[model samples]
Target: MKRRIAVLLAGCMVMTALAGCGSTGGEQKETETGSIENKEVTEKSQDTGESSGAEDTISGEITMWTGTWNDGLMDTLLEGFYEKYPDVKVKFEYLPWDGMEDKYLSALQAGAGPDVLDMAIAWTIPYASMGKLQKLDEYIEKNQIDVSDYYEGAVETLYKDGSYYALPYRSETMCLFYNKDLFEAAGLDPESPPATWEELREDAVKLTSEDVYGFGLCGSNAGNTTAQFYSMMFSKGVSLLNEDMTASAFNTQDGVDAFTFWSNLYLKDNVVPKSVLENDNTTNRNLFAEGKLAMFVSGSYDIDPIMEANPDMNMGFALCPGFEGKTSAAQLGGWNLGMSDTCKNPDAAFALMSYLASPEVSVDFSSTFSSCKSAVDNEKYADEKLKVFIEAINYGVPLPGSPYMNQITDILYNEAQAVLSGSKDAETALADAEASVNKALQN
Candidate 1:
């Protein structure tokens, strides 16, 4: 997949006049790293009419599994899908986050899971390794789907080992969410969010008050902590793993500096609350919503929740800040739809996948939820914060799509908590983590 993307990147650079998909309202941008691979298709020109007669006729009962999407929104979107594939029936099996992996594994083992799996991008490699997903490269090429219109971060996450296992339906990247009211109270410009990490610290110190902390940190969960730290590390051009995915690359000077910067905020600067060590994403977001936190980092999805939690809160959003000379990087995440290995109707499954990924349908879907550039061309449905989130994708990078990512995150999380809890310094903790992860990679 990497080699193929390298080729595509070269092609894209030389092929300056390549056809673009979806609405051409905004300028399309490349990812932080110039790699282009197709997974979730971007915009399909409306000229490609629906399949007809015998060849286009795909009929079968295809089951789909997803997390927390509103039934009404899905039904409305699928209405168009059903119109195209009149013979294909879809049964959606909605599941909660709790025990979902176990449920999916058991069902797939018994050959009874849904034909389509709408799952987290992190799960793609693990499930693909388990031989639970169908390879989509052939399908993508045969259909001539152009994924270049999709956010580079979103599409890149589904590519692995020279194949793509899923199509990214939606995408999100982290942004700095701040309380404008708190900034005004602290005599800082409400419109001017921090442009650099040092500025962020200076403003945070000034914004910190007896009742409210300047920053809300969620350092409890291993995954959550690693994700937050990764945004900082990537901004400094520090990768968690080496090129060959053979060992940890995050114990170096840049890695240590990144970790130290975040840790010092909680320890030396005391700009974050002690409970930060116990908090998760939800906790920090809620704290910000309640106006107790002057600034926090979270995804675009948190916009509605924050607004709902505090209707009148003067909230502001901006891209994640980096060092003065460094480029910003936001951690990207979202759901993708994968075909089951045991799917009986491969053609029908592909049809459904393409339908969901189609520009028109994707636009409607993204309208009700956070989505990628390929899905929505304009900010018709987005507010100021959403616009910031969308623009940040140009600097977004997905977490290392290593099969051992879960294990590595576990190690980093534990080491990070140790640093925050004063049990270990950043150097020692990261070094220990590096040794452990390298050992795991060797195994």
Candidate 2:
């Protein structure tokens, strides 16, 4: 199966490369002047039923800035795109994820940003609000692409005030991953994964040992701990805002209850280890793989490494458990592709975007990269472990994508962490977060 997929991807890469060669012939004509005169030609072609091939005749170079994939896969995908449209030369600049936001914002301010950009779906709203991204509604409509095929949660993250500014290349959601071997040793049912908060707490207590932790909840200063906690809040029907992105709603009873639940796991239940207070996502993952953790919240991408590292360990996954009567909730985090407002060849850029967003190409990307959804429905790509992740998306929500989201998220995490460590009570912690978030929103 892997070999067949690889062969098909290689063929697609070659075809894409050939398209790039064809586009190179017209690069001179397209670059002779600034401001994309080809837009007018493309508009005329639209009326005449001419295809993207006709638009390819007018070409100019465009740069693409990306931060997601490692060098190997990044080079392959970019090379494939370059092969498809040689006329529209792409200057690919890979950015490190750590300082990407500042770098992108600085470039935008300096008026020297890339013509094609990759960003997390959560960053879409802030960038679009700053007028740094091009609105792609017309381009999408012109191409007659159906947006419904993409995961609904992923697609919604790219919209602001009814305008589409980005298209997701990959989507991800969290799930509860457990060690089957640990479950059996603990005298618990290995196949019966926890389905509720109570069940999870009970299982954790039963699984705890001197050498192994019952659960690995990353409570360190890492950003994802806050994200994971926020998803739990959502499962209890709490939200940061009241759907309008205008006010603080996270201080409600549901929010306090959720925080208290996590706090008790550390202080009273004693199921979670003290080491979790200093661990990040990688640390937590490594602990689980090393057999020090019985269970942890993990994404689909963690499967290969964990399996490879511990060949004899029986790993399993379940949907993130729910609160009371609520359904399980997972948080969406992934990258989206968009044409820069400065793109010299919008027509060609749109064409490339359409091809990349097609179901066929998306399926191949998901298979190769272990991503959740590209253009294909996630179900098509699911194995047993992946199915748990797919199931979680049904109730998954995108992170709050407001311009003030970053600041608010920081406040939320700090206050919640204080409560978890017993430095503050739940009521005081939530009140502080509410005040902080409200002030940030006002500013």
Most lDDT-accurate candidate: 1
Candidate RMSDs in order? 10.0, 11.0
Could you give candidate 2's per-residue lDDT for residues 1-443 as a string of tens digits? 00000011100100000000111111122111122123434445557664555545746766667643332344444444444454555455766555666677677756777877766666666667667779999988977777876677777767777788887656667788999999999999999989888798999999999998888776775366676677788799787775666678988888889888877887888988797668776677788999988988867767877888887878889988888688898676666778766777787677666655566655544422222244224455556666666666656677666666667767877886787777999889989888887786665
Best by TM-score: 1
In the range 139-204, model 1's lDDT, one tens digit per residue, is 999888777767777777677668888887666667888999899999999999997888999999
* lDDT for each candidate structure: 0.71, 0.67
Which parts of model 1 are misplaced by more than 4 Å?
Answer: 1-56, 68-72, 109-112, 366-372, 378-380
lDDT of 1 at 240: 81
Q: Provide the clashing-pair count of each candidate structure.
A: 1, 13
Mark the 10 consecutive residues where model 1 has the least summed lDDT.
10-19
Q: How accurate is candidate 1 locally (lDDT)?
A: 0.71
Mind sharing the TM-score for model 2?
0.82
